[model samples]
Target: MASSSSLLSEEQFLCPICLDVFTRPVSTPCGHNFCMSCITSYWDNASFSQCPVCKEQFQRRPDLKVNTFISELASQLVSLQTSYCDHSRVLVLFCRDDNTLLCDVCSSSCHARHNVVPVQRAYERMKDELENTEAKVQQMIQERFHKVQSMTESVKQTAERQADGFVSDMQREIKELQRTAVKLRELKQTTDQLRFLQSYSSTSLLPHTMDLSTVSANKHLEMQHFGKSLRKSASQLRVSLDEMNTEISRFSGGTAESDAATLRYMQQYEVNIVLDPDSAHPMLCLSNDGKQVRYNMGAGMWAGQFLNPNMFTSHLAVLGRRGFSSGRFYFEVCTGQKTEWCVGVATASIQRRGPLVRSSCCGLWAIWFLIDKFETFICPGVPVHMGKVGRVGVFVDYDKGEISFYDVENATPIYSFTECSFTEELFPYFNPCDNEFGSNLEPLTIVPVCHVE
Candidate 1:
C-alpha cells in the first residue's frame, strides 16, 4: 500500500508537457506544476496565459519560481531507478573491447582484461563528434540553398534576354513588312495614273508590266542581311558554349592522356581475333591458339600442299574469323621480332585464289614490314620511317573512315589512312611473309590488350 502511494507521488512531479521527470520544476500563478523550460516554451507559443489542465485564466503573466523540493525528489527517483548492476552501483566506467557501460561489478567480471575508460570521457567524445556532424550538415544545407538561388537568378536573366531578342526580331520584321507595303502602294498609284492617262490618250507612256525587280532586289538584300546576322549570333553562341565546356573539363578530369591513356581506355573493347586457316595460304602455318602465324619453309619442298580454292595462292596471308562492318575496334600485333610481315584490315570480297593486288582499290589497307623500314600499301607505296618499333597497335574507326597504326612500345603514332570508303565487311589480315632462307622466320604474334592497372 505504501509503495503504490509513492508511485502516484512520483507521477505528480513529472512534467505534463514532456511526460518526463522535471529537471527544474516550477509553479505557475494558477498553482499548476511543470518544468521551467517546458512552461516557458508553452507560454511563449500560447495566445494567452492560462492553466493548461483547468483553463483558468491569469490576469497577467506571473514569474515562475523553481520548486526546489520537487527537483530533489525527481533526482533521487531517477538515480535509484537507473543505478547499474541491479541498482546497487552507478555506471561510471565504459569497456572499450565489450563496447558496454560498466559499473564496478561489471568491470571486475567480464571486462577484467579489457581496456576500460571513464563513462564521462566516452560521453564527451561522442558529444564532440555529434556536434561536428551537425555543423557540417548545416553548412551543406546552406551551400545548396545558395546554389538554388543562383540558378534561379540565372534562369530569370536568360528568360529576360531571350524575350528582348524576340521583341527586336519582331520589330525588324514589322519594319520590313511596312517597307514592302509602301512599295506596293506606290506601284498601285502609278498603275492607276497610267490607266487614266491611257483612257483619254492612246500613247505608250508606261511599260506593259510593272518593273518590281528593284523592289525584289531590295527585299533579297534584307533577307541576306538577316541571315548573316543569325549566322553570326549562332557562331558566337557556339564559341561561348565551347568555352564553358572547357571550363567544366578543368574542374572535372581533363581528356585522356594523348596516346598512352587512350590506348588503355580502348583496351576495354579488345577483341579475340582468331586466324582462319581456310583463308590462310599453303605456305603460312597458324598456331594452335590461332593468335599467331608463321611462314613454313616446307611449302617450297612440297610445292603443292593442299589444293583448296579458298587458300591464298600468291599472297602468304590469312584472314581473321571475326569481321567488322561498322563502329570502332582495335588490336595489337608483335611485329618487332619479325623482319617481314603485313598487318591490316581487308575487305571480304578480296580475291582469295588468283594473284592478289595489295592496293587500296584492291580492298587491302595494310602496313608492309620489310627488313629495315615500314611501307604502307596505297598504290605507289609510301615509305614510313618511324624507327624500329616492336609492337604495333591498329585502331579502326569504320564510321569515321579512319585506320590508324601506332608503335605501342614507344607510344608513337606510325601512320593513319583517312577518308576510306569501305563497301564490305573488313577482316583482320595477317601475313608473316615467306621465310627468306630462315632469315625472316620469326612468327607474328597477336598480343591481347588487357587492363594494366
Candidate 2:
C-alpha cells in the first residue's frame, strides 16, 4: 500500500475544481474526489449540482463529508513533496539570500552566514509578494483597457459628427440641384422666346450646374478621407493594445514583438510620390521617372524655360504631382550624404514666385538639415536634435492636422507638427538646398516603402 501510494502522481492528489492539492478531500456520489470547500463553492455558483470533472448531474445536492483516506493521502503527498531536500534531509528553513529551500545540515553549513527564515514564514511572505505583484498587474491592465475604450469612443464620436456634417452638406447641395432642375424645366417650357432668354439670363447657372465629374471626385475624396480617418483611429487603437501587450509580456517573461509595429502601421499609408516637373524651380532638375530631384549645376542655363505659376522660382525646390486635401499619406526620401536638404509637405497654393518663407505660417511644414543642424520650418525654425540619418520619412494626417517626420533608417521619430490647420491641398515638397560647390550635390530620391513583417 505504501509502494502504491508512492506511485501516485501529484495530479491524482489535486482537486479538479481548484486545480490544487486537495484540502479536506471529499468523495462525491459519482466517485470523484474534490476538496470539500471547492466542490461546495462550485455547486453554489452553478445552477445545478454536478461533478465538475465528469459533468454528471445529481437531483439533490449531496451532503459533503471529508473522505479521511483521500484527505490523508493528499496531505502526505504535499508533505512528501516539500519536506525534503535533494540530499534527503528534512527542510526546516529557507535561505533568503539564495532564495532556496534548505535542510538543517545545509542551512548550518552552506547558508550559515545568510539571512534565513522559517520555511512557513518565507512561504507566506513570498506568496504575499506574488499576490501583490499580480494585483498591480491586473490593475494596470484594467486602467489601460479603460483608456483604450475611452479613446475608441472618442474617435467614434468625432467620426459620427464629421459624417453627420458631410451628409447635411450633401443633402443641402442635392436640394439646391433639385430646385435648379425644376427652374430649368420651367424656363424650357416658356411660350415666349424673350421670356425664356430673360429667365435664363437672370438666373446664374454657375452655382446650379451640377458637374457629374466634379461631384464624383468630391464624393470619392470625402469617402477616402472618412475611410483614412477610421483607419488611423484603428491604428491608434492597435498601438495602444500593442503597448499593453508589451507590458504584459514583460511581466510574463516574454519578448515584445511590437517594437516595429508603429513604423509598419505608418508604412501601410505610404503613397506613390513623384516630383512635379511643372512645379520645379529652373535651378532644380527632376529625374525622368519623377522620383528624384537635384539642384542643377548650370542654374542660369534655363533662361527661356516656360515659367509655371506654381513653380518655385526663388527656392531650389519642387512639389510632388500627387496632392492630398484629406486623409493620411506617407512617403520616404533618401537624403543620403546630403549636407543641405529640406523635405516635407506644403500647401499646393504656397507662394511659388520670389523668395518664399519656409515656415508653417507661410503654408510649409518641413524640416531643413544643414551640416549637422536640423530644424523644423516653424516661423523661427525650431531645432530638432537626432542622430545622423540617411533616409527620411514624412507622414501626414491631413484631417488630424498633423505632419510627422521620422528617421527611416533607425525607425525613430525626428519631429512632428501637431494641431496644424490645413485648408488647402498639400503636396510633398523637397528642396535639395543649393549645391554649394558640389558639397550637397546628392539628389533627394523618393523610395518605395518596405513594410516590416
Candidate 3:
C-alpha cells in the first residue's frame, strides 16, 4: 500500500486554465476542476460559455460554486509538496546547523548530528517569531494612521479659523458701510444749506466713508493669504499621506502570506510584451511573433543583418518593443531548462553600445541566473537562494519605484529592487546569456499571462 502523499501528484490538482494549483477550485458541468476565478475570467472574455477542457458548449453560463472537497485535497497536496525532500520522502526533521528541512534519509546520511530537531519544534519557534514581527508592523501602521488623523484635524481647525476671521472682517466692513450710507442720507435731507455744506466738508464724515478701492485691495490680500495657507497645509497633508502609503506598500509587499495570492494579484497588471528585433544584438535571433529570443552562435558571420542605433552591440541582450513610464506592469518569461539567463526592466536611456554596466546606477535592474547560482545584477551582485526556478515573473510598480521578480513555478519571490528613481521609460529587458559550449542554447520565450483572478 502506498501512502496518501505518494498516491497524489501536483498535476492532478492543477487548474487546466491557469496551469497552476487550484485556487478556489470549482467543478465544471463537464466534470473538470478549474480555478473558479480562472474559468470565470475565461467566460468573461469569451463570446460563449464552454468547458475549456471538454469544449462542451452551454446555452447559458453555468453558475460556479467552490468545490470544497477538491479545494481541501489541493491544499493538502500543496502542503505535502512543500514538505517533501528531494528523495520524495516527507521531511520530519529540521537541521539547525544547515538551516534546512530533512527527510529520514537526509537526516541519517548528510545532516547527521547537525543540531537536528523535530520539524514541529522549529515550526513553532519560527511561528512565534513571525507573529511578533507581525504585531510590530501592525503597531507601526496604526501609529502612522493616528498621526495622519491628528494632522488632518489640525489642518481642518486652521482652515475653519481662517474662514471665521474672514467672515468677521466682512461683517465689520458691512456695518461700517451701512453707517456711512445713513450719514450721507441725513446730510442730503438737511433743510439748512449751511448745515449741509458744513456736514459735507467735515473731515469726520468724509473720513468715515469707506474707500471702495482700498477695501477691495484689503479683501484681495486677505484672500490671497488664506489661499496660500490652505495650499501649504494641503501640501503638507499630501506629503504625510504619501509617506504613509509608501510604508503600507512596503510592509504588504514583503509579508504577503501566499505566493499564489501574490502572483494572482500581480497577474492583474500583466502586459503583452514582445521582443524588439531592431534593438537585438547582431548575434541574437528573435522569433516571428517577437515572443521568443535566443543567441545564434553563427549569426555573427552574417553581414546582411541590419544594426539599428539602439541595438545592443556588445551584450547578448534584447529589449521589448514597448516601454512603461508609469503605473504597474508585469510580464513573464519561460527560461525552460536554460542554465543561464537574465530578465528585468532597463531604463530607456541605458548605454547599449558597450559592455553593459548591469546595475541600478547604470539604469539596469535585473536578476541573473547561472548554472547553480541566482543573483541580481547590482554592482556587487546579491545572491538569490530560490531553488530551481523554471519560469520567471517580472513585476514593476513604476510609480512606487519597485521591481520584483518571482519564481512562477513555486510562486515564490526571487528578489526586489526598491526605492529606485526612474527618470525615463523602462523597457522589458532580456539576456539569453552566452551559449557556453551549447549548454545554454535554449530560447527565452515570453508566454502569455494566464491571469488568475
How many backbone clashes are present in model 1?
0
Structural similarity to truth (TM-score) of each candidate:
0.44, 0.44, 0.50
- Residue 338 alpha-carbon offset, candidate 1, angstroms: 1.3
Q: What's the alpha carbon RMSD for model 3? A: 28.4
RMSD (Å) of each candidate, 1 decimal: 35.6, 31.7, 28.4
Greater TM-score among 2 and 3 belongs to: 3
Give the C-alpha miss distance for residue 32 in model 2, angstroms: 65
Write down the worst ten-residue block by lDDT for model 2: 249-258
Which candidate model has the greater lDDT, 2 or 3? 3
Candidate 3, residues 335-420: lDDT per residue as tens digits?
A: 87788888888988888887976555888998888775688887445567634567888999899888888877556678888778
Model 2: per-residue lDDT, tens digit, 363-437? 999888877668876644456864356788888878767787776644556787876888999999999988663
Native RMSD of candidate 2 (Å)? 31.7
- In model 2, state the lDDT of residue 207: 40
Give the candidates in order of lDDT, highest first.
3, 2, 1
Candidate 1 per-residue C-alpha lDDT over 1-453 given as tens digits, one digit per residue, 9 for 90 to 100: 565235645576778899898866887867778886687678778888887777887886665656777777776676555544564676777766655667888798878899887776655554454345434433433333333233333332223334334334333433333333322222222222212221211122121322222222122232223443433444444343333322221122222223444455445557888999888987788899998898887755244644666677778889999999997888999864666788899999888876786555888888887765789865434687534567888878786567877766544567778768887899999988875623777888899873321
| Alpha carbon lDDT at 121, candidate 2 | 71
What is the Cα-based TM-score of model 3?
0.50
Off by over 4 Å in 2: 1-259, 301-303, 379-381
